[model samples]
Target chain A: MNPVLGRVFPGLEGRSLRAAAVVTVLGGLVGVIGGESVVLALVLALAGSLATLSLRGRPNPLAEEYGLLPAIAALGALAALATPSLLVGLLAGVAGLGLLLWNAESARDTVRTAEPVEGLLIPGLGLAIALLTALSLPTASAAVGAAAFAVVVALALVVWALQGALTADPYAAKAL
Target chain B: MSGGSADPGPLKFRPRAVALFGAAGALAVLALATHNAVPLFLALPLLLGPAAAATGAPRVPLSFRVTWSSEGSRGEVEITGRLTPSAAGPSAGVVPTFYRPEPLIDRAPPEVRSEAEGIAFRLHWSAPYPCLVSVARPMLHWRDPLGLVERPVRVEGDALRLQRFPPELARASRAPLRRTTPLPGEVRARQLGGAGEFFAIRPLAPSDTLRQVNWRATARAGRMLANDFRVERTGDLLIVLDLRPTSLGSEIDARLASVAAAGAYGLAQSFLDQKARVGLALYTDFVESIPLASGRRQRYRLLRALQAATPGETAGPSERLAVSLRRYFPPGVTTVLFSALADDESTLVLPHMRRRGFPAFVLSPSPVPLLGQLGPRPTEDDERALRLLRLVRRRRIAEAWSEAAVVEWDDYWSLSSLASFFARPAGRRAAS
Candidate 1:
């Protein structure tokens, strides 16, 4: 790692944060390529960068840190507006938001311990994306429509809450 | 990894958490109004981030045990400790932030090593100068997984206070004690007729004891002869540190003061070891003196005073040392002065001390040599000006020799010369 970049992302010492960064970039690229909007790609990339910056340099609160989540959400909304397929836009936006949040959370404090938070977050996010993709597929039967989509969303939320409670290793949580 | 960073205190909700929820809510409202699932999906992570962080909040209170010890004056501080949670619970790891004040130069932070028992860390802080430095106990920054909450717990321990000075100073006991007080001590006084080093054999007196009779001397004299030994009584040493500001400027004056303090500490320690009554007088705007006393308590007192001395507004007249001496010390006490003798005023103090019956020895840490290291001269004219300044300083010190004994101390680091100088009488020392 570059010394300058190392200082900016002190949490990068762990593999989890590096993986989060790679995942966020890949997700952002997928959304931009799928939607065919270069502008959305740049905006999503900026959002990822902003979230990363929030956890940078000595764990003190950055002046622009609070704007991170809102900025990512706004970028997602823009992606939605640009794409013809709502599902594609949603997947891309969700992927960027999820990965960036993971990256930020992986380094929560300055501790350099392995993150169990990633275990809980990554699986929950993967399950949500998979269910959403399955429901939105055109090959789906007529029975799996808006009603079915709502049911699946509710089930995913329940699974997410259950997963958080069960997989929660409170002691395993370490500093970046 | 530097310990100089600010402390991130106790567990509290971060604004980022509020922003995450707020953004999530706004996106959700937009999704409902537009009847679009895309905006709703965008809100998922932001909402879940804080939600998951909330669930994983630290349940057990965290604390740490930190202790520090210094090897020597030049050695680094060895800090070791372990982190402990209030209950057998969360395996969450926390980074403890160490506080590094000015004069502490190390860049590396404490390295944490987890053992079978708990999380332990070790740190070493190398101080570069002979001065006092205090490092605060480390603060454990316990952060929730998603960084939604932060709690900085101060470790249970006192701050590490390290007083570094030259170890050679312990040899200050070898310094000669020419003058002596009436009190009993280790060094031999000039007077005869006591149980000490042999002085001379004299005709027997009526009160002389049989043990005092030197049989060989009596046989040579063909009469009763007695042995007269020098009295082994202690001496009163008043170490005066001239803190008065000189023309050398505050920066040089501060360095000079530091040097003087180190020198004074060594001399005091040496003399105190020989059972001499050592007192201190810091001659600043007025005068502060530690009354003449002996033993370990006096050594501690002198050390405490030297550590506290700082350079600032000190321009006391030369007469203050003399007048203060009369009040706090005996009239004919042996006085050792630590001064830069940077100006005429500084040189005058020794004469004042001598006039008042106090035999004085001036250890002048030369400011002339120090000025050379400050930096290069800007131009030839500046170089010429510095030369003239040096000449003037030389003349001032030369004039001071006519009054009291003076030793020009050019080198700051090496105290061997000063140690040898202290062993000899003021009359024998060559003028600076």
Candidate 2:
């Protein structure tokens, strides 16, 4: 397994190999719209294969911890696939954001309980955000796409911040 | 530990600076191209706002978390560490180095190796970045990076205090009492008797039945004597722990404490098996008395107190031991003192106990005798070197205790050894 691919799409290895395949196929479809589908498909296929291989023989705590992130991404992708409508895409985007928020809250609670739940959630959210961002671009104008990318980035930052802060000193004085 | 170097402060707002420079360059280019003001409009916010934010953003406080299993004499243990931006929040990029003060047996630098489980940072625009570190063994060290501006903060939490005691060796000494000694005010043969297995035989007392008389003894003595037998049950045992700071020399103080603790453990087990009441009186100069009762509950209570004991620096050796003995311990009980006997104070307490009618057994894990063979110098320049030497000496002292039946622990042994040593023989002896 190539370390680079694992780093790029952290929690999407394992059962999510199918998800990675779907993403690769979507990239190929994009290439079809622009007449370079073969090249896009090859690169995506390589990345997906590397990701799937990296997941083997490894305990995917990250996968379990952030299971909802991919689920939410899949939902968004399904919604986009169902209708190319701008409104539906926007609603799907909101749903992805909602999933991110849910994961963040779940991570915070897990830290409170001193459990390793965040291990799954962090990478799970990373994969979902990356996939959804890639999927949402077609329906949006350049400005809107940039804005959406910024929002996703901001959300990632928030998740990182929350994980750091929440786990820093999870238990209060009374709990100790 | 080396003092960490200074950090290159928060990152400069280079984007804003470039933007400002670009704006001026663009204005000049535009003027050269068409004498137009269009370039000025593009450069204003680019040069100012982001650069201002970059300069204005608060530095993220860097902190760390270190979690490991309990410490003991085990050869290997796993430790996990996490480095995160502190309460101020995540910044663009931050790397943390994990440090430990214990020995590590790995060739890799003391940095986390697996970024998958490593620290994850949120960079600008909320992108997640991960970093991993691997440690080969459990130890004590620190984590600090090249730049020290935002120093790594230590996350404090419960640390497992695993102190390995010395080994337990079979001792040559044995108890002199062959008969049970009974307490006064009880007339029943089972309740009132001397210490050990045998009771007594006397002329059939008013309450004694004819069947209670020992016919063989009566025939030999030619009298109607009743043989009364009592069960071996209650007796007193006292344990004195030496907490002098000097006693901690050469031995990892925690391990030294553990060895002393093991003696108390052995005594408690012995007393419990014999159905005798056992009491504990723990003391250092500063902490004079933590008197524990003799029973099932007291056994646990004593161990708990030993676990919490730490050597204080204030008192001299003799003064501390003397004060503890005088203030604590019940009168006339069998006393057992566990110490390294490194100082005069602790050694003198034994003779004092003897004068007071309590047979005090001194269990010293003193290293003075073994020090000559163990090393060349009294001290070393390296901190780790000194600690290792101390650990060796502590184990030597533990070995000395194992030689005496009254005490327990062999040199360089661990808590498990002490546990096993006392388990069988102590049980059998006490049951008898």
Best candidate (score: DockQ)? 1
Tens-digit lDDT track of model 2 for A40-125:
43454345334433433134534334233233223322332232333333333333223322322221111111121222343344
lDDT digits (tens) for residues B1-432 of candidate 2:
111222324444332134334433554354335432222222222222222223223233334444444221333323334433333333233333223322222222222332434352211110011001122222211211111012233354344333332323212112311222346222222244333345777777877766677799989999777766665444555667766666445344444555566545655655554545555665555544555354567766766776556566555544445445555655665566777656445556555555654445555553432443434454544545556666765664454434323333334343343344336666325322
Q: Which stretch of 10 consecutive residues in model 1 chain B shows the poorest summed lDDT?
A: B1-10
The candidate that achieves the highest TM-score relative to the unseen native structure = 1
As a whole number from 0 to 100, the lDDT of residue B18 in candidate 2 is 40
After TM-score superposition, the amount by which residue B318's alpha carbon in candidate 1 deviates from its true location, in angstroms, is 3.1
- Provide the TM-score of chain B versus the true chain B for each model in turn: 0.69, 0.43
Model 1 residue B195 CA deviation (Å) reads 11
Residue-wise lDDT of candidate 1 within B225-268, one digit each (tens)? 99998756546678888888877788788767777876788777
Q: By lDDT, who's the top model here?
A: 1
Q: If scored against the real structure, what TM-score would every candidate get?
A: 0.67, 0.38
